[model samples]
Target: MPLLPGAEPYRHEGNEVGVLLCHGFTGSPQSMRPWGQYLAAQGLTVSVPLLPGHGTRWEDMQLTGWQDWYAEVDRKLTALTDRCERVFVCGLSMGGALALRLAAKHGEAVSGIAVVNPANKMHGIAVNALPVARHLIRTTKGVAGDIVKPGVKEVGYDRVPLHAADSLRRFLRLLDGELPQVTQPLLLMHSTVDHVVPPTDSARILGRVSSTDVREVLLEQSYHVATLDHDADRIFEESFAFFARLAPSVGKEGTATGG
Candidate 1:
């Protein structure tokens, strides 16, 4: 499938500490490109893969589900692991769930993790209908481009696919059960007020995960898409510092060595 312009995946070559960046559900890699470019500019290897069923059209995403989306990130993580001595994973919203899953399954293989408004569980009475809705309704309102930054746009589908959403719940259920296994250093960045995902999602993760090294930062200016909003610079700088402290080390020619 041909991708929309600026929605294509991106990769930047750098040192041995590789970072795999995942975009949110219904959101394309375009939302993460600026951040990836910023990290890449620092001579750190970076990848932002376009998840399956996204970056094209809404119907295309309806045909794909969580597993298809996850398979793509897993493949990218595998590639990064092979090339770098240490790897870190970060994601937005649903992508955050995928990052945690990677850390849980890969264990010590993943050096650490950072997430922006990670969504693992849904709230409100609307979620009670997801199972039945998936069989009846095709889609509903979308949670995209929720940035407070005026004029900034996140290329994504305007409608949320119910079938795909059901898959998301299944993936989250599996992930929530395995959260205790995630013991890597974690940094959670979230907005103070979000219209889409509530703060409880992050609280759930913080409480469930067994990671000893964990910190949370509240984003005061940004909304759900904090990566492109006003606090974006903070996200970039903080996550870079987070990665720097854990990354093995950079040798001559910017290659990574023992930390």
Candidate 2:
């Protein structure tokens, strides 16, 4: 299948410290490319994998679910751990949930994590309707391009596959239980005026996670997709600094370094 423009995954093997980035639901790597490139330029090995059923058509997304999406990042994380002494996972929106899942599952293997507008649960009637809606409808309006910056658009499907969305709901529920398992340092950034996800999502995560090293940055000028919005540079710079501070230094042997 041909990928949409700007939907291609990104990878940069720069140093011993690795960062894995995950995009939002219905969003492609395009939403995360610039952030990944920025980190890569700062000498961190970065991987932004195109999740399965994403970067294609909405119909393709119906064929996949949260498990498929999480598996892709899970596999990528393992690959990074094999090559780098320390690895950090970062994600936006649903990707944030996936990143948290990785940190929960891997524990100390993940040095730390950073998330932008991370989502944990759905709000309003849609949450209740999703169970029945997935079977009755094929797709619904997509939550994309919620940016304050003019002329900037996120690369994602115009429609949200209902089946996939229902799966995401289930995934978030599972993630809530796993939040306490995320003990690594966490850097969370959220847009104060996000149109898609509410600020409460970030607050819920902070309250649930076991991580003592937690930092929160508020984006006043951006929306949901802050990574691609007005606060893009701030997100890039701060996250890089967060990972750098947590990453371990190379030892004399260099092969087996401290993390």
> Judged by lDDT, which candidate is best?
2
Clashing pairs in 2: none
Candidate 1 lDDT by residue in tens digits, 1-259: 7898889999987888899999998999998999998888777889999998998888898898888998999999999999888899999999899999999999988999999999978766888799998889999888898888889988898998988888888888889999999999999999989988888899999999999999899999999999999999999998988887886473236453322
How much lDDT does candidate 1 score?
Answer: 0.89
Q: For candidate 1, which ten residues in a row score worst on lDDT?
A: 250-259
Error of 2 at 257 (Å): 16
**Consecutive 10-residue window with the lowest summed lDDT within model 2:** 250-259
Q: Which runs of model 1 end up more than 4 angstroms from their true locations?
A: 248-259
Root-mean-square deviation of candidate 2: 3.2
Positional deviation of 59 in candidate 2, in angstroms? 0.3
lDDT score at residue 245, model 1, on the 0-100 scale:
81
